[model samples]
Target: MTSTERSDTDRQGLSYYPWWLDNLADDATLEGAAMNGTARGAEAVRTIVAKARELYEFQDFSYADVFGDNGFLEIYDSSIQGEPLKVVVTVTRNAAGQAQDLAVLHRPRNSLLLFSRLMHEKCAGTPLAAHFLSDDSKA
Candidate 1:
C-alpha cells in the first residue's frame, strides 16, 4: 500500500491496516503494561501484536492521530474474554518512516491482569514467554 492508501475499517471504524504494522523497523522495540520488560526486534513485536489482536473480542477506536514529527497515537476501547479494556498505543518512527518504538498502555487493573494472563497463556513455550508473567505469578 502507498502512503495515501488506507486499509479497510471494521464496523467500529478500526483500521485493518494500522500504520505500524507495515512500518516497524527491523530492530523495533515493544514495551508496556502487559509486558515484563521489553521485546526487541521486528519478529518479536509482530508475534506479540498478532497474538494480542487475536485475543481482543472487540475494539472500537475512539481517537487516533499524529503525535509529533514522527509519532502516532491511538486510543481504543476493547474487550477480551468478556472483560472491558482500554488501551493507548504510541508508535515512534525513524527518519525512514519505519516504526522504531511501540508502546502499549492498558487500563483498569482488573482488565490489565486478565489481558496479561491471557497473553502469557498464548505465548507459552515460545521465546516471547520471557517477556510475560510466569504461571506462578498472580494474574
Candidate 2:
C-alpha cells in the first residue's frame, strides 16, 4: 500500500503498539529502500512478538501476576546482542481486552540493553492500572 493508504489505516483498525511494531518491521526490510537504521529494528520486532506470544503460551507462561497495576512486557533483541540498550517503550490500551496496558517496569542506564523485564499491568476488562497515564514509579 502507498503511504497515504497506510496513514488512512493508521487512524483505524490498529492500536499504537501494533502500529509501532509494523513501522519497525518496515524499517527492517528492503522495500522501504532505506540503507540504514533497520538492522536492529527487525530483530527488536521479532523479539517483541515472541515476548507477547509467551504471555499466552501453554508452557513456560508466567500466568502469575507480574505487574499489579502497570502493563509490562519485554523484548529480547538478538539483533544487537552484547550491545547495551537505553530506549524506553510503553504500550497502553484503552479497549477492554486481554492485552490492555503495556508498561515499562524497569529501565537500564548507560546501556539500553534489556532483554526482558516485568511487564503487563492490566487485563482488557480489569481496568486496575489507573487509566494507564498513571505514574507507576510514584505509585
Best by TM-score: 1
For each candidate, the alpha-carbon lDDT, in order, equals 0.83, 0.29
Off by over 4 Å in 2: 1-80, 83-97, 113-139
The superposed Cα distance between candidate 2 and the true structure at residue 90, in angstroms, equals: 8.5
User: On a 0 to 100 scale, what is the lDDT of residue 45 in model 1?
Assistant: 96
Backbone clash tally for model 1? 0
Give the CA lDDT, 0 to 100, for residue 71 in model 1.
92
Distance from true location, Cα of 31 in model 1, Å: 0.2
Q: Write the per-residue lDDT of candidate 2 for residues 55-139, one digit (tens) a residue.
A: 3212111122223344433332211234333222344323332333333322243122122221123222322122222223322
lDDT of 1 by residue, 38-111 (tens): 99999999999999998887667766778879999988888887889999999999999998999999999888
Instruction: Give TM per candidate.
Output: 0.88, 0.21
Q: Which candidate comes out best when scored by lDDT?
A: 1
